[model samples]
Target: MTRPAHIAHLADPDDDPFGPEASDRYFNRELSWLAFNRRVLEEACNPAHPLLERLRFLSISGSNLDEFFMVRVAGLKGQQLKEVDRRSADGLTAGQQLGAITEEADALMASQQAVWGDLRNALDEARLHVLRRDEVDAEATEWLETHFREQIFPILTPQALDPAHPFPFIPNKGLSVIFDLVRRSDKEPVRELVMLPVSAARFVRIPGEPARYVTIESILKRFAPLLFPGYEIGGAAAFRVLRDSDMEIDEEAEDLVRYFANAIKRRRRGRVIRLELETGMPEALAAVLKSELGKTDAIITESGNLLGIGDLDTIVDENRPDLKFPPYVPRFPERIREFGGDCFAAIRAKDIIVHHPYESFDVVLEYLKQAAIDPDVIAIKQTLYRAGKQPAVINALIAAAEAGKSVTAVVELRARFDEEQNIYWASALERAGVQVVYGFLEWKTHAKVSMVVRREGGKFRTYCHFGTGNYHPVTARIYTDLSFFTADARIGRDAAQLFNYVTGYVEPVDIAKVSLSPRDLRSDLLALIDTEIANVRAGLPGGVWAKMNSLVDPAIIDKLYEASGAGVEVELIIRGICCLRPGVPGMSENIRVKSVIGRFLEHSRIFAFGNGAALPNDGARVFISSADWMPRNFDRRVEYMLPIENPTVHDQVLDQVMVANLIDTEQSWELEPDGRYVRDEPGDKPFNLHRYFMINPSLSGRGAAIGASDAVPTLSLRRRR
Candidate 1:
């Protein structure tokens, strides 16, 4: 192949496929992400949602903001400190972006606090009040006092900030309370700090009929004077700090695992990125905190109530199902049920595409388990990006390896936030004799693939499983993803080739059925966009439909804008941040953008191009990918986008997943050029895509397969007016 076209910056004038007008309407990527998070925080106040679910949304917002601070904010801070003046695609300098981000973050935090207040009141109405230490009844207080002395006081370490005693280390994201203390004999005031134990619960549920509660911090604050007996009681204010948690590893180091362990330890003491203080905190106390933490006034924020609301997740107990969404158990595909749950037999019968959450992940577990025990199976190769505490997938891989099967497991060591767990799995896999390769040092291997090389009848054959999500079963239960199981020779060969490239760096010359990143994924996509533009200019029935977690690559967005301007209808189903502004008068008149937010997370990446023809195979191009349209995926990661050539699978992805997301109004938000996400209100005939998916079986369902035939449903194509 001609050394593929050089990758150009998204904002370069030469790459502006969509004329000048389209560029003007595009929103800044960073700002659009902040807007997406605002929507998440907004969900906490949504009256239509259940109270517990709303609380869960609040926790998600907090966790999301923490990640945003650690990565995005820290990255900007680094760039600014290095005096790098490179502007973002939207033309904003690092300092400018930081200023805008701080303003937006403040507003988001304000909204979060407001929603928390609303949720607290709503929880109170439900007879579950989170009481303060002073508000606790006399009996509850006495019990708590005894409980604290037994459970907490032993772990407490209070340090005074004085010449004699140095200020202790304040860990990242750790909560502490600053107070004024006066000695009995000297009659002089002193400042002190108290660190909250990480392992302890943030809220202590009072023993009562109605279930009142008190914060652990509040209890600690009330009992601080007791810990220091000769000191007079003084005013105290609680605060928390966010730090740069992103890890930096040296590839040249001899011991990768030990280096990471040390890095993890250092992460706890990372430079503070943000400092949150309790509302109405005295200026003196706030100033003391700033000086000690070495943070500027710009980094300080004040909020009402709980500083770390993610702790609310503990309160959303499984015991309270009545206060949450009705628990819906996933159903096994009737085809599997028809075969007495023989995964191998079912998958071998025909290529199948399974939609998760609606369908049970038990089937995936079954596949691996069967392969682990099957005498016919000779070897297995798998790529693991993220897995929960106890992954059945990992167990299956270990079992297969121990059972004398040749298993090669490529586990990415740099899965951000899950690095520690990956390290643990690496050790376990290594112990089991599984060839565990921690991918390339420079790139993160993110493609989700599993291959089982088996002997069938007379010859060795490859059975491949390509997915748009991680192997983590817990996330599979909530994140919307697609899984493709196939016996196609070309696809199997392609998958095997990819494993080779990642493990041994021998890029296959004939990779027709898929596009792998860090090699060809970006250029492949750009060429596809260019082809779509060609068909549009040729006056063919051209259109583009894509769904991903985010869209920040400026070049791709510009191309899509050009396609739209050239009379190609563009429809997008972005679940999170989207920088490309749609529906502007002259810029994106032909483009329409909608975001889907509901009970489950929309995570599958689907791209479709109408190649001047009809439906399935009628010049229609479809692909399922493990990458979002982000710059990192394009440049710094090993990702893949596999074409869905099998007509049945293509129809299921396009006709079902793509179309449903496009029309979903209840959970959909429309994006404006001005970085505003306006929720599509309840109209006369409000259609909720999530509710529909819950009740309506997908096109690949057993019933649909038995009834519907070779004719695949083509989604109604809408075009620019």
Candidate 2:
């Protein structure tokens, strides 16, 4: 529990003479996140990706923006409304940040529309048409009218917007159409609103050879006469609402489950944060809609053409392999396959690291399944941050529990957007007799670890699995993560202590190998950086390489700045929201930062330090983590950072995984000191890390299958000396 000496000076502006003004030393976290989304949007314009894949990127960008507004922007709006006197790490007030966010988000929304327009045209040219009303032919029109009457009309309820009716509540992200109409009998002007059913598909596919689709709004407009038999339709416009979706848990609530269930219900009706209107909406109509929604302070944008662009993912799901990236089949780790699929046997032989997306996630599942059915396994412990709708992991734990083995599942109910699923899993686990422990109400248990204790030779031996991603199988296929399996007694003991700490609130006194957050993770990381500085001062080669999803903690940024000042070479591969301003002449010239956004998300957390020698050597200190370099991760969540001690596994992670990311050019972006990201250009030799991993087997995964003639080619560092 050693705190860095400079921790006290980090908040003082006058501590470092070489650094810029305290406010100017880092980029705004919110703005940096927007930049990352912009990069995701850029991939939609990248020709290297197949047509459908590019469209998928556009859909992902839209979804990312929605979440950003729901969580990040909603938090700031709350602060602004409460008049709280808090400033961001970069010194922007809540109101100031919102103003800047509005400007940037408006531009981003416009770009998304522009990209969608282009992709729409490309999709049409590829014989996949998203047709306009005018483009619908006679045969398709006849079928669509019939299809709408049968499939969509029954779910529709039109509410007259008159003095007799109060404004109806619009659910979060709900899309609805407002129509100007005239009653045929009295010729009276009237207004009606129809809420689009969330159960209906956003795009209705018309039966045809080319696979044409029409928007549900288009169908509603086309068949307005069918629904309102006595009214003449006039000018109509569509609008979508985005409400505050963040949940606040009542600290004093007697029942935790009841609290979350009520919170989920309340989130749908939370204050409206954004209103997106399709262009050409009459000014009076827009004013009325905004006033009804109580959106005077909400962000209002005239979204062109498409309202909920995230729905474009439906079209991206068309079964046209030609318009998508070639399908890839993941390989099961040879080390486990070599042991006849016995996970414990392979781990007992040696530590193994499985590179996910390239190496199949089935190996992780197999490990759990084996533990569930094995007669020798007497106990199972797991942590669940996000177990998807169809959770095989939960099933395995249930099976073990039903078999009378002691099973403990730490289900975190505050995983944001996945809370409901976690709740369902917790109930199911408890019904199956599994001991379900909801971790600390204040701190989320974000670490991904599973351990099994087996009776062997009249003693218990623990086998552990530590991962940098969720237990969700769907994401495991596309997210680049590491699954480390080990039987080392030190790490096993630490894993048990971690479980004990979360389940029983027993603070670990002397953890041997791994560091836990809300305890000593931050201080330990700072000490590691300080070690590199000491190495440099003693005339030894000093280096550090780290990768994670974000780097927003000010204290950590200051520590890295201190390392850079002491002549330590620091290379960071931060995938998103990096506030650290690298390449600053006197402040951070020795530090370099880059982000990789490509076919697979870079999700693994790794840190390597040169322990008095050059990096990528056997002596370097390498570790894998479940936490990012963010304030909430270090101080507000229960997380773990474990060392890579086995020689082979250490070499595989440091040399292969870390080295490939550092050298990637096609999908990498270098961050400038001024907050802009410049995409790395492939000069002479273009190396794509995703493609390399997809083609080459990882070193540790190859196991005894690796012959002398098939020695894995080594990846070397581009030395900076």
Candidate 3:
């Protein structure tokens, strides 16, 4: 009957329970993200993981931090420069956040370097050696010199740092070695810079029995003499710089593609936000760098070994299968298999949900591939946020156009970091006679939806596919996502309306099944949470469970805190950047938050509400979503939330996917009241959801082979192998 303590304090209202201890109410968004990266880094140090897999984890952490600096940190720095002294939810100002983030990030970078050093030993133990010049044998040195002359020396360009040469421009995330060079006769030291060729391999492989390689930085240091002709090589230190990469585009631009292309060029010249120098560099050389780059000490980082650990991925040997995760073959849904891979017939049987990584994304491609070639199909529509390197999806769309069927693709040119790929896709799609439309400049069409109109018995019918991840084949192998296929008339109509809304700016009204954000998705979410609270107040079983990538929207957190206080159990699985403070006594004690980090990325968004019954109880409410509980998703982007009304689909999402995530103990980390994460211990009985999914198939996809059950089927560590 009364407002929850947290909800009563929007904007930290006076006398609000949430405002009294503002610092205790939520975690700082920037720091929360860094913590997630820490979790990823932990996997690199985890000996349980394969050697190359550990390196992969370390590489991922490095890349994650790089983006954090480029976007989040860069934005915060901009705010600081503009004197925007506003406090985040955790009561930290822009400057304060930067100060704190720098501390955390510095420690994380150190940990990464340490792990890489130890991992190098693990690699050598496995006979995959990463050798330094000193470690290389005389024979290996001769071989290196020969290879250096042929492969590397040809590309070296030395720039003298004198009045005539001035300092050369280094690209963002660019690697270069600073030299204190001296002329033989003058005996005066002259500073110089040698940019590492970006086109060359990061590590030069040495020809040997036990695979060996030397980092390019090491090779540069060893061969600096050869490149510098008469000048003697003095002191050298390798350094790298990371610059602001977040793009700013004019919303009113006539051509989105042209604007993005030009903006990307400007992004390369943005202000430098972070710098890394090898530890123990000459103070004189460091001073020259400081003056040349005009950066403060706050942005400077010292590397223990090699700079840019993310580049470690380049050395991941594909031949060394024993040093990586066992290759997994995704299961093709039996229903589709039985239907001779005809996605339409399988969907016609009933609504189908395919859990990805475990279940192949080929089913999604099957729908598009079939539509492109099928004689009955007359129209194909889809939204692409990130197409990745997969030629299959785009090829299918192009084939549909070549077949003379009407094909439309609403490409979001603003998909961060994928802007270039999308630009190319847009151009290619247009050249193929497909209708290409860039969605509203104000809102990115982040929702992934596809519809195929086919002629059957003189009537046109639409088949739909909704996914929580990109159309990226590479990501599908590592990101755990969902793909739902259905021939249901209501959903198809809703899909058609959505496609129209995105491509044609037609504000959809009277939508039947799906909820769209920036319009009604948030309202629908609030109403669902309210239902759970009301159910609890009415003395019925009530609860709320949501799994998403983030939870930064204050309104959503307030509602969650409301539900938690009203005796509605709340469990959240937010993989990154959760702002809500869970398990805070007197505020959100009933809310429990957990993050899962494992072999696969937890990306699929699923929600469940008791709806006046216990969770997953006979007919509890269930839904799949392409949006997280974040402000950008709710207010600035196009997103979708689809209700799971079909019996089998509901069971599959709630009883299977959601349940497994909740029960996973092996890869889960619990969030505490103080914002610290504690990894769950198996205690002799570990349950790994990833392993479970890899070994087993989804119940809904089993088709007639599974026995019918009255109760929703559940699987747990104890219940299933």
Candidate 4:
């Protein structure tokens, strides 16, 4: 699990000018995010990845770009509509950003199409084919005809476009085919529309072949003439409409549930932001469609591939295991096994940190389930931000409430794209007698902290869990996150206070071990950065290293710039948007930024600062947090940052986890000061962080006897401060 020595060759931060309007001072966050997606697309292009896995990355890139437009680009469009002249911290006006985003998005799509073309050819060779209508064999054509007449025609509804019939409303992310039909009687051409079914499978599996399939759009287009019997079909085009899906909830509403429910309804009819069309669409028809849809800022992108390739997930069959990453079973920590599956008994001995996708998340599920069944457990409190459709955590909470143990769940109703799901869960929880509390209207409860009050030996003892990700079981299998279980009195006390603050609206006091955002986390992070600056002044080899999903807070960026100016070495592993420009001489010469995009998503957050010594020294302070260095995370969301105290857990995170990411060569992308990312060139020894975590057992998760196996990462650098 060791990484090759490569960090020493990267350009040192000491290489620039401190300026307010320097060309290389800051990178545009929007452009930076697009760069991250490009890296994901590169994985799809990489020859080393399995064929289906490459398709998965391409599909993910498509889905990610859709979200970016629906939210980030939509926000920008709104600002431009309102004539707000405000510019981003990177100095681009809203209008300028929209233009830049469109250009980058187009380039990304072009790259995706090229990669997809390669994948399509490879899939053909692998016996799985995405057949165009003309390419379908005679045997398949018979099955497809019957499939369309029986399966599709029954559900198909074609709307005639004329003066009497207004263009029918299309839902968000809906794909449709617009057609020009000529009436045989009048010898006049008429405009018609056929909206694709939303619930239908995106790809229809051909019966003879195992993996061969045809897109729903292709099927619709082939049988479209059957949809119009009275007229001769002239020109037809397949297009997709992307509407603004951002929900706007009123903060002053009396009933939070009702407000959110209504907002979800309104979200369906949101303004159209983008329209995607197939290449070779008629220019006259495109103009007509644009005029009918009254959105002045509607973005139009014409593609040669399928309209919505994100739906390719439907055909990525699980039957072909060899076409994906080799399945790795998650290790249910030996620490829990040592206590015979009793989480409480295991936590009593020592704290444990579980890295997900490699280490199991079932432990978190079992911990909650055990609390629900344990008579000694009296009260349970938890916060859920983005629990998926079949979250086991919600089930455990409901069971506990039904069992009569006092249960309170703070559910964030504004988790974007998950509002409808969260609202339903909130109602279900309330029906089951679990006290459902919608957190602050102005701020989202984004923290992942759960607390249990247990009656241990006639005295109440509290157990707490902190996480860098959500409590969703499905996401746990793919997203790399952290789950920390602790019995420490101070952490438990802090957890209880934080929950009380959210549910009771009481300001917490005497909570010192962990930092909470929207109150003081920003200042605390600044203080850590300042400590690095102070260390450099004291003749110490000061350094700062942080890994998070994004870094966009202007003030925090300024603090890091100052730390860099003071000669403290700084390195950031930002998986997504990064506003700060590293390697800028004079201002940020001592700073570098790199992003990791690969098999497993990098979602965990870790911040380690050299108080007065080099990074990885025993004295260096390390903290794991649910918050990213973003303004919204700090100012508009509830978040938590936990300082790693246990010697084993600390080394496991800083030495093993952070070091693995910092040295990744296969899928790493280093961002230059000029707002471009250069992929790391493979050396003689190629190291992939995802593969490293796959084969290695965690330190704290492994118990005393069998935990010392060769698969466990060796602890050679354990220096405690």
Candidate 5:
């Protein structure tokens, strides 16, 4: 994907700060991800959030770190162990990146503990106490004793760590306690390892008014004598293990389902990537754990009293609405209701976009449900990636197939940790007479698309629902994403071609109205950047505004740098990992980057360009996508980027959605060239994008029901000098 010849001379190798030879131009992707997690940790410290909400953020940070170690660190360790000398985009070798990641991750883990400590105290003040072992009063102890004997002791199994019995296998993310015990009979020392049952709740709540709780580990330690009656308890501490959970697909495997089933089992026993011990673990016990489970180059960290901090989310679920974010109910699209809930009628009139978490995701499900029961509907094609445990979406598909409609589901089994669930979904879908196709062995099908064909008037009209997020109802309530419902023939044809490309291995050729990856998506994006540069050179207005989860693709970043050098004003709202260094003097001085992390996750992907006019205008180009600006998204995934052509939908996405993100100050963080993110200061008029969206109706979703008196507020960008 080379730049156009007309603008090839725009970059001066000798003077370009982001030139190919500049090693320092990009930040390390791993370190940048750690930095993003730090931003999440910072939210735990933000006093503006409700107390339990802050605790929720802290728990999220802990969970994020666990996955990072299980996948990212494990991959690096694999490369290092295999003696592969591959380097990162920023020019660091595998070993070097691992060293840096360890440093950053350790500090991040420490910050998470610190935040947890603060939240724990805050919880106590709010009348929700997480009582320590010593704090358990006589009344509580009597009650807990019965609870332990009845509920927990029955599941207890203690294994001695001796030559006779080898160390027990700890599952990935397993939390256990190593006990130092001396036999009462002979004063003989014995070490026992007690693995915590995954079925048990991490926190056991006492039935009382103040809502008191205690950690299961604490209860076990307090009642160690009950489990080991013949021994006196000595030094004991808790520990947890994080194993390498990443799966490797064998290219030569005969069956994908069987391969993944075995792979999931293997992942449970994969090499331990991290060992976290309590801060006060005895040296003898720590050494035993290290020698046994830390055989590989596993990072060992000494954590606080809490081992699995991610389990704090269980406590956050307590019925304490007073200490959490205010309850929010998403609004169903007014457009869909305008047709008396007829999704086909709304789309047949014109295109519409549903903003999730603000507008309902149930609308997406309703569209499929309607199609399932519609006698005129003849066919349905959907892509499944990260559908949550619920079967709402799955049930709709099965209904459509059972209704005698042609239904095909392209289920991706390589969706990271969601592999097992995807497999189960695929099997269930196939059993329901749905033609389930697992897309390419190498490239994952990550596109979020659903198409339905219905006979209308005299011809078959195809209606497509393209989303920037998954069809999962749970995530839809908290993730900010876009769902575009369209009956436009061009997009409908493109959607059909996309399905064919995935199901039949028929490559899409000269597709109209959309760009698909592993083909020309990257080159197409570059061409768009080139157009912005050319517009500047031709003395017309030039600008670019894009938002995504991450920005790590070197080719795309370099093109943005060239565009910035050519006087195209570039603005990006990347929520997570971003390796590009914005505002470098000679490299991207005209570019600015910010991240928005707030009440809801920013998961939507949007891109807009000034087509010979200033942005937020009718002449601008807008598109929503299922791909982020990352290497995995571009080179190894089946993704799509579709343009927003309908004027009302275009105005809604660009004017309301994109503009609110740009103008948001409460949850924004400005990125510096030095890789530090400074929080955006919300001065006098502190505008919150989330709050704005929650209150106002989206333009396209408002439909004709919105009268002049029900005027939705307008937003405009601050013109650049």
Candidate 6:
């Protein structure tokens, strides 16, 4: 790929705050995240996608924004309240960034509403009607009335607005109803707020053909007289509040667990960051809400359609397989089956690399199951970060522990939004006799590594499983992550050191292959880059290829810019929140950046660099890590970056995954120095990388012993070498 003249424009200081003339060109972290959300929203508008899937995407986008507001926007608001006007690297003050964010978010909300409108119509044509109050039939209305009185009415507590009643406490992210209350005898009106019952369904499906849906707000409107029988009906609108839900802990406190408990309580009562009101609300009522909530003008928003459309997740349960993509059940690799489901045998036969969803996560599950039943297995060591509903991984650990095997599981209780799930798993593991250890009080242990110590042939051998993703099997269908299984003693020993570092705080000084973070991963990466830079200066062929979820650490970007200036080729596949400004002349002329968005989320952090040779051995380093190239990953969390050494695993990652992503034109978006992402124009020969993976088997699979058939020549002779 050749550099374009637009690179000069990108490098101009005026184009960005950190242009060539200025100090640095840094993109706002919050803005880059918003752009990622926008890309997610774009999926809803993609007509080429399935209608229900598009709706699901919209709901997911909405939920994502809700969290972003609760965390990111709320944090910014806190900074502003503290009179902290620290300017971001993008040269915008906290208040200025907040103002810009409000404008951008408002526009995004409007776009969401517009897209929802189109999706609703499309869904209606497919025989699904999200009905208004007036659209419900008389028979369904009677059924709903009975259902409301029996189910909803008993649980609802409606407080009359008077001297006796005070404003009800609104929980964070709680949806409610606000109205103008007027007396029956006298037509004088006063403000009233009726919090919509949280326990009730957001969408009530009307009993009829094609399943008509009515929102809870609409139902409340239809039954307004029931709540206020004597008072004259007044204007009512639905609203929702998003409060600061991010937990804060007292690091200086004596007990970390107690402090977290206190933090959780405080999080529930966090200050309101956003107020979303129904469309056509009485202006006076809206103003009163803003004043009561202590919100400024910017916090108030008029939601023209549904206030909390994330409830559409209920609609997505419609069992309409025809309207959705064909559900794909993961296939257990033939390599494992050929070994009669012996995970150890399959892994030992040849280095096996399995792609998730396309290739079964069963291999991971089977690894645990095999260990659980194996009489020779002595101990199992694992890390639990975010285990989904019914985590088979946890069950396997429990089984192993119950079977009188030494099982140690490091469970992170501080996984945000997953604290409850983690807590549940921790308790379950404890009950099952598993030695569950909550990580260090200060740092989160985010590394994903599992080990099994087994006695074979009168000797103990450690089987290590290192993955770039979580142990959540549910997410494996969507998130693209990498997993490596090996019996290498050196790698297993390094993993043991990592486990001890978290559970026992014994940091290893020298690691044979693996590089650990919050300690050595950064220096190791920098050293690698330095080696590449030297090669470039030496007039040797050198290049860098890295794939990550996000990149925001300025120091790393600066290092990359220096490497770019050294004539080293740098290609980045950053899925979200990239602060680096690529293709800037004089700054990053040799750098190119692209992101892949497709049916599956583009995850899996892979880092590779050319060894100034055809194959990278000790000279060329390739790593798969669980950490994103961010400040938190480097300084705040415990992480690991393990090198891919085995020949088959190396070739699969380098020649297959890395090469395929670099050449993909479809589903790719290029980020400009101006912080705007431009989708790659379709090539003359359109190539869908995701489709290719779905249809074709990976190189690792084809190269496997079982996949080798009579039609193809055997590679046994080559392997003998």
In the predicted model 1, the residue pairs found to clash are 10-555
Better of 3 and 6 by TM-score: 3
Task: Encode model 3's per-residue lDDT on 27-55: one tens digit a residue.
Answer: 77888899999999999988789889999
Output the lDDT of residue 294, model 5: 89
Reference-based TM-score, model 1 = 0.94
Ranking under lDDT, best-scoring first?
A: 2, 5, 3, 4, 1, 6
Poorly placed runs, candidate 5 (over 4 Å):
1-22, 703-721
Q: For candidate 1, write residues 1-721 as lDDT tens digits.
A: 1110111123445444444344364566676788788888877777778888999999888888888988888888878878996777656567767887887888888888888888888888887788854577778878888878888899888887888987777777788888888889898998888898888888888775687778888888777766778988677899998888888768687776788778888888778888889998888888888787755323778866689877778777725666798888887776666677777677777788888878877778888999999999999999999977776998999999989999999988788888899999989999999999877777899999999988999998888889999999999999999888887888889999999998998877799697998888888988888887898788777778999999988778888878878887888989898878777666577888888888899999999988787543465899999999988899889899998877777877888778778777678888765556789875765666666666766544645422222222348665412
Candidate models: Cα lDDT each: 0.80, 0.88, 0.85, 0.83, 0.88, 0.79
Model 2 lDDT tens row, 1-721: 1111212223344433323354567677888899999999999999999999999999999999999998999999999999998878766678877888888899999999999999999999999999976899899989999998999999999999999998899999999999999999999999899999899999999875789999999899899999999999987889999999998877788888889988999999899899999988998789888888755488888989899888899999999999999999999998987899889999999999999989888888899999999999999999999989877888899999988899999999999999899999999999999999998989999999999999999999999999999998999999999999999889999999999999999989779999999899999999999999998999887888999999999999999999999998899999999989888888888999999999999999999988876545648899999999999999989999999988888888987888889888889999877777899997766778888887777555553322332233453334431
TM, every model: 0.94, 0.96, 0.95, 0.94, 0.95, 0.92
Best of the two (2, 4) by lDDT? 2
RMSD to native for every prediction? 5.0, 4.5, 4.1, 5.2, 4.7, 4.9
Per-residue alpha-carbon lDDT of candidate 5 for residues 405-512, written as tens digits (9 for 90 to 100) = 999999999888889999999999999999999989989999999999999889999999999999899999999999999999989999999999999999887688
**Regarding TM-score, does 4 or 5 come out ahead?**
5
Off by over 4 Å in 4: 1-23, 702-721
Q: Which ten residues in a row have the lowest lDDT in candidate 5?
A: 1-10
Q: In candidate 4, list every pair of residues with a backbone clash.
A: 13-589, 13-590, 14-589, 16-585, 16-586, 17-585, 618-719
